[model samples]
Target: LLSLIDQIPEDQRPPIKLPPYDRFGWFFGRNESETYDGTFQVGTGADHVQNTGVMRLWNGANRTDYYRDTCGTIRGTTGEVWPPFGRLRGTPPNVTVFAPDVCSSVTLQYLDEVERYGIAGLRWIGNDRMFDNGVHYEETACQCTAPEDECPVLDNGAMDVSECKFGAPATISFPHFYLANDSYHADITGMQPDPNEHRFEMELEPYTGVPLSVKAQLQVNLHMRNYGLTLLQGIPPVMLPVLWFRQTAALTDELADDIKIILILPDIGVYVAYGIGAIGIVGLVLAIYFSVTRWKLVGPEELPPKRAQPVMP
Candidate 1:
């Protein structure tokens, strides 16, 4: 169908018919079966604490063809898994994750310390700077260069993923346009952004680098504008949000308990050993001090016994 549309000359093409759907119905699910045959090669380093799982190959390619230059480079672990931080000196300021679906690597900023089931975790959340398309964040300028497709110049919080989607007029943003520009909310009527609910975040046990809880939220939008095509005509320039989704996960109670026993108990044992050794050293010092005092108290009386023994010799 795409090839057919391309074959038709723009000057002679007729008004294309669009699929039937309600105009206002943007939040709904469609029952469709899809198949994915992509391969991911990840290097499982010696263990969680050692050289751990980092992405080696994505869909049989080391680099993506979506964006140009370093923006297309594949780095960091897949969003789902990461190498263990293990006994680091301090909390990490950020964590890098390579999102294969988005065809980019995103850095999750450290928000705060959070605890679940008595286990402490470092909460990392996506900020306003990550999804920028060179409008607000200048570092992502390379991402604006779409290698094969014409990428739109979107405002902050929305990223053009048309090349990744095989030239579909698709873009991705935070759910409800949480960090998007005010103009986007003004253009749409039903958008109500909430930081508590719409934020994409992950909570990790910083010591083991285990994800205790995760809520990955993303909204898919269609850049609907007249591309000199009949079907696309009569539509206002708008980023029409088609659907939004949130993927969530959490650690079970049983697993949390196991982590405490495995990781927490050893520290308690070390503390107990130190306490015992401290007590023993204090007792030995007290004994030495008391013995010296007793000898000093008998000063002249103790000297008389030594003089009598010297006279007998």
Candidate 2:
């Protein structure tokens, strides 16, 4: 069977493709809103759990700046609010959960405010490094209907209900540096975002060989649509892509084998050859220079340098 599989043509083999992902897009103002609901399975057998928190901004406020809200609640397996729900009128909320073990799973449902602009969804995955610390990994699957009473204006002058579906799913992954050992910790780096297909890839150095007891925290940001007439008309809305990361214990060995098979020209080899060739050319030039100078000399010792020396008295 292995021999037969190897005999198959390269083109006949399945192509390597990324996992399913999504991205969040801001809505153009017109009294439109979006929501997302999804079930997440936490791997790595984490002991503790916490919601990383949510951020949002309205028109005239700084773009990409999020003020934490306090209106959301995280429910446990018993259907009771885990940390208790808080009211958020003008602010976003912090939805965190503390799970008992890694065997637990949770369903996340989030609703955005009704704005003339639509909502953008960001999906994320976590690494073991996020456990115990106040970090998280989350993904926003897609939008759904807002809670009955909390739904915003159905139709704004500029927005149509049907247009809200334009948003795509994106995967995002990055560390929540704010929860690091120091408040002045390094900013989350190595984040790659692909808005078109809604995918992201990031490597975590801290979570490499940690035991299964370490839980991975997924963090996601669901950006609400901005409704400013200037922004809606003048500036093109930027796509908020999602990110994800999967733990692979065998990745290191696999990568090492790949490097061995790959061919790369060595810089030292090239330079050494060039240096030897250059030295040979220089030696030939010096021989020629000496021959020419001697040919021009009156005698074997009559060259300028030899002549310049005083005769032995």
User: What's each prediction's TM-score?
Assistant: 0.74, 0.20
lDDT of 2 by residue, 136-234 (tens): 222211111244343322211011112223232221123332122332122334433323222111211111211111123333322324443243454
Candidate 1: worst-modelled 10 consecutive residues by lDDT: 22-31
lDDT for each residue of candidate 1 in 177-234, tens digit (9 for 90 to 100)? 8999886786798898999999989998867778899999999998888877666778
CA shift of 88, model 1, Å: 3.8
TM-score of 1: 0.74
Taken over the whole model, the C-alpha lDDT of each candidate is 0.77, 0.29
